[model samples]
Target: MTTLTTTRGDITTEHVDVVVNAANNAMRGGGGVDGAIHRAGGPDILRDCITRFPDGLATGDAGWTTAGRLPARWVVHTVGPNHGAGQRDRGLLESCYRRSLEVADELGARSVAFPLISAGVYAWPRRQAVTVAIDTIATTPTKVEEVRLVAYDAGVHQEIASSLTMATSVRILQGVRALHRRGYHGLRVNPGVAPSGLFWRVVLTDAADPGSSVRYTSADEAKFAGGVVDAMTTPHEVAEQILRALPRLRPANDAPAYAAWFAGLLAAVEPEHALPVSSADYFDDTDGWEIGWNSGLRYPAPPLDADSSQ
Candidate 1:
């Protein structure tokens, strides 16, 4: 089983099978986790990485080095991306975790440690960045038994704690749906109801925190609104409609459903602009959430009212 752990300590002093150095493309010393690992592991680690990975590893790619003075036998060097949205950086960051695990598995290491990649001086907001890091770890099918995310400060620690909360929220939602399947609820969306052509559910949040309250709406509404706005005979007509819908939202945080729906809608609407649709690509996102679709395995749509058939 894979487990998530948090700690704050020198990666070198921590007694583990491997310590992952949140590294840079050069594999040389810079700041943050990179500098720390290079400083503790000594200059030889850098020299070895350079010799071993001469092609200049891309951001999110990883390589390995001897632990040097660090307590572990090997140090996996992974380059995380700088913070950005839908930028190539996101892909690179995902690659960082994927490559690191690959390196660890190749070495047959059972345990590994990671710093909050790109969340420090790299300017990735601690909250958003940590989610991506944790999500990447959770979704990977690698054989490592334990993965520790070492948070260096209170801010980073809180971020990791929040990730835990989000994961819990997901579990709770699953439980709710499961209970409904067992006839535990008075009003539940029938799991048997087949999805109707890329429906979206957007949850708007006032507080950005994962645990905050949220308001939900169907994506069909947004699509209708867009069409209405485009068709309005006068500017006032569109503005009036927007104002009428404004009060529907109260101050609250968006639930995970919001993000999941948006990601899916984007892919469904513009497949070219979205990330690749696969277990590998879905795990690559910060959400660490997975959704799949198959033409032959679909449930019957609304009128048919039949359960899914594989």
Candidate 2:
């Protein structure tokens, strides 16, 4: 499957196999992403457009040319339907992505970067533009390993990637809701603050005691957040709203004296397999006492919450 992702950067500097440009049918050069690519890629691109596509290109169709000087090997140019000019067929908007990918595949491009076609000067609604671009790229069959939806600014980048975080937070919400139905009491969806970004911490607690909890963190690496948010803040408004409407959080460090009680809880929960060692916390006091043993998930790990779907 082609991994769809978002990056907040200049598409011209993208070091991918191909950089898809949202060009006018004239194909020579234009504004926005088109002009940027042409300028960065130098005059050979214009030369290729003049020599190869003498008649320009058809709306919604795509053609490729040499990258000239850009890091990419080729540039796939597609004409997006001008929504402002009354050409509003969404199929044509979707075609910009589909045809670009098709052209990329013909060039055997394993990776490609694309701007949100028509979202700029053409004035296609930004949200709808994102939807069409992702849906078309995802449904299109190709061998491309990675496709980046490149945004020119931090805000646009966050808006594009929020679609992904919405899915993740929803899945997490549903999961905790399931455990709540299963009678698990102490629960939470919290963050582990890091320098780059936050990691997810899903805590499930003992049904009877309601104090002990087993943590399931999303060990995945941090995504590019465009430097807009992290553990202290997040661009995921849906997740924040979901968490706020859920339940009261019980801080995990509240019962540190009982840490040993939940120490072996993970093993008991999954008796069939041994859980791997994870980075945790160690407490120490300088009373001239020798360290005997140490155990626990990372400190300030997050907090637990009561069961509530609302």
Candidate 3:
């Protein structure tokens, strides 16, 4: 599995196998990351670019050059779509990341560092740029073991972190659905957990009104059934909490069948949070029959009147 992370630092200084440059189509190096890379890597980079890409590259395409004086072995140059020039096709922007990873794969790079392409002089919206970078890199298949999304400033780093948190929250919700399909009852949503954004908490209750509560305020405070499981901030913690609570909620007989049912439910919902529904909204259906897990299975849902206990 690939690990994705973010940091605030100079992309040219990253000690990774490959560092990506947000270059213009000219590839001779312009402002922003392109200029910083060329200036730091010295003349050998330009010399190699001239010989390899004499006519320059098109937008959304990528090529590599010698790292020159930089710490990395190779500098993968990718031209981002100019959002200010009215070239707003998201596919072009996504192509930049996809093509760069393809180049990295060919070069046998195990770790790669990337800057927020097109968010600078190219005028791409910062939030959208970060989203595209994270989503594309996270989903794209590559042999690379680690991918770092580098931000030049603290503000940008925070923005990327927020995006990551949102992504993890979506994954946690998916995990909650997975546990529910396995016949693990007493699941509830903690809406008050997150004051803003899409960061909501999911709780596994032991009864209609939980006599006990495991408050997950900080990483150090995370506990499941009076024992440490995982940090509340991680998606793995969500899965672990549900698994640890399973035996107490249901019998151990045919556990594999329950696991298989959970897997099937997980696979049925593609693209993580594509269901267009939330745990809070699950009981709003007036028909009294709980919403079906998927199109094929329609198990009766638990009563919703007790949701206020959260």
Candidate 4:
């Protein structure tokens, strides 16, 4: 699974294996992404392009060159179809991303950042361009591990993000609830971005610290089943398969609140063949997960959709 992350940021500052440039058919530096890439990457990129392609590259195709002053190791330059010039072939637009990934694979690049091709001066509709980028990348077969769609601003970022199906966070919390690996440990449900693109960082450890040291009644003792979240052991799992991932995953906080969550789940698990569940009434408005699974538990209120409110 090639994890896709859509964020609003400058592509030039992206520290990744490769950055895809929406270059013109000439391959020579011009305006928009073409000019920005060349300017940031310095003269070396242009020199490589000229030396590598004296006759220029064809439209809808891609090739690699050095990433001079930029943070990336290589630049995959692809010519996008100029929709403004009556070049409305969506295949050509899709080729930009597919071909770029091909080039990235050939270069052994694991992570890549892309700009919305043809959405600038080329006049490809911005919203459609985002869909194209996501669809093309998601369908293509490659060794690339991660692809980040770096939007030019917050507006574009919102479009890209909104285009994606919100990964269900409650599912992930359920997965974490089934802890088992090797070492004895406790659990922490943290929400953040990871290399594999999970918003929640599941921490399982027995380290002695201000936040982690309270397990034992003695200075050297510890408690509970010890093991890592094995779901992460495999590479490229999708957000849904993410310890089940991406819905508004605002699980209860681990610090101060972890003890209560742990105690409740432990008690619920004591019943044979039953998965643990929180005391629905204790939830109030904290975590947005389903309020109750116990038949006897009262229905507190409506289920909160985490991503919708965000």
Candidate 5:
């Protein structure tokens, strides 16, 4: 029952049994997901596929090969319909997902991760592509326990996340959907200056925000003190930077300002100086107003009780 959305991450690193590579018909690495997978998995993967796939797969076709240096044991290669050839057939793209799952079933892969097929360098419309992918996966059945749709950018990931949230809402209305837990929490962090490796983690529980308003906690006190000088010298500049730390929590149509602010924060906070923490960790029944943290956490507050916090 676990479904999640992520942006631009390697599937093999998730420790999933297999990863789907959005490969070209020839099974050769092109751009986007195909090239990334090939580069990460190493040449041995290509060597294994050389003799087995002499005839290049056709559009809407899929194949498999051993994972070379990737964490997964196998890679499911599928050729999806690229929009470039004036192709707008939704069925063709849907088949790519169906066939990819079929290949995973045959390979006995317990879990698999998917990139937004045909969306990247292929130039497929993001919204339509997401709808097709989510719909196709929702209809498909398999032994696979999990299917993760990995996005290449924040906008992409946010769109997919919103779409899934909407779909889940509809299912709930139809009495077909059930939530695992209320008050779900998610954290996205960058370890380096640029936050290249965005760490996203989530947990579902009923724990309240800790009650305390200490600006400097045990974990962050030293860092806060070290940053005090910057804050004192450039107080206005630091305030501006803090104001810019908010990310777009909702769809673009709804929160463009938040998105802009998030970008600003990403630029403002030198990743080396002040890394953001998830909201759930910031506030609580005990802690009143911890101002220095980020708010990626979604709690089931009074009016929205039982609401699924995506």
Candidate 6:
């Protein structure tokens, strides 16, 4: 079975078998994810493109090149439809992902990382771009074991998580509800607090008094009621934040068990969001966390492990 996940990070650093680049038809390297990949993969990638694909490629088509200095072994280059250039064909956009996976299969790549094709400089609508990516990648069959959708922007991560129909999002929603049922109050995104870069906040208050609220930021800190916690940038991270707060808010010896359950839920879903925010301190201490329905999927969190130390 193929597992889908999302992350908030540089796609060039992905240690998968293959990393898909959202390239222009020229394939020489342009902007957005394409430029980042080309720059990180070093000159060898461009050299391969010059030698192997002297004539460039067409929109929606895919080709491969050496990874160069990147962590991955191969780079699958796919040209996305430029919606800003009057190219609005959904099929073309979908073909970019499909063709990339087909190319990955040809190379016997077990895992592939993808960026949101046509959503950047191509100007595809963010929500529709995410939907197309999820729909096409989920339906397409391949021997690849894992498909990672890497988003560099917090808003883009939230958009992808919201558009995903996988069971992980559903379970994460359920965990939010479970928090409410446990008598934790004021679980919301505080509009009073503005977002700083990729870091956002979620405020959880004591059920008895609304003013006695504890704020959780996208960083790790030690505090009583209000302090920095993990970044809830993706669905998995959101679920993890809730799970971590449960023990602090209420009496629950089974926090570890619940964490395990949520982790399992995350593993079962397609297009899962995986944001690693353990060492990121993008926001200042004065900028308290933001709280809202969408805030959960705007920041990143630590990875979920069987040891339950997430």
Candidate with the greatest lDDT versus the true structure: 3
Clash count for each candidate, listed in order shown: 4, 0, 0, 11, 8, 16
Candidate 5 lDDT, 1-310, residue by residue in tens: 3244555555546578878888888886777778888888999878877866888788887888988899888898888787977777778888888898899999988788898889976777777788778767766767777788887688888987766643432222111001111101211111111133232221211123232111323223113322421111233332222223222211113223322333444333321122333334324523221212343322222222212322
lDDT of 3: 0.68
lDDT of 6 by residue, 9-75 (tens): 9999999999999988887988888899889989999999999889999999999999999999999
Where does model 6 exceed 4 Å of error? 165-310
How far off is residue 69 in model 6, in Å?
0.3
lDDT, candidate 4, equals 0.62
**lDDT tens per residue, model 2, 1-310:** 6788899999999999999999998888999999999999999999999988999998899999999999999999999999999989988998889899899999999999999999999999786787677657756888999999999889889977865443342234334444333333344323222223234334444334455443434443222211211211222332333334344433333333233223333223221111222222332322211111122322222223322221
TM-score versus the correct structure, for each prediction:
0.57, 0.56, 0.65, 0.55, 0.54, 0.55
**Model 2 worst lDDT window (10 residues):** 223-232
Residue 238 in candidate 1, Cα distance off native in Å = 43
Model 3 C-alpha RMSD to native: 8.3
Q: Model 4: C-alpha RMSD to truth?
A: 14.5
Task: Look at candidate 2 and give me any clashing residue pairs.
Answer: none
Compute the lDDT for candidate 2: 0.63
Residue-wise C-alpha lDDT for candidate 4, range 18-133, written one tens digit per residue: 99999987888999878989999999999999999888988899999999999999999999988899998889999999999999999999999999898888998775687678
All models, RMSD in angstroms = 17.2, 15.3, 8.3, 14.5, 16.1, 12.9
Q: What are the runs in model 2 whose C-alpha is more than 4 Å off?
A: 167-310
| Candidate 4 deviant stretches above 4 angstroms | 166-310
lDDT at 74 for candidate 2? Answer: 98
List ranges where model 3 is wrong by over 4 Å: 174-199, 203-310
**Lowest summed lDDT window (length 10), candidate 5:** 174-183
At residue 264, candidate 4 shows an lDDT of 55
Better candidate number, 2 or 4, judged by lDDT: 2
Q: Write the per-residue lDDT of candidate 1 for residues 45-126, one digit (tens) a residue.
A: 8888878888767777787888888888889888777665333356667677878989899999888998878876567766
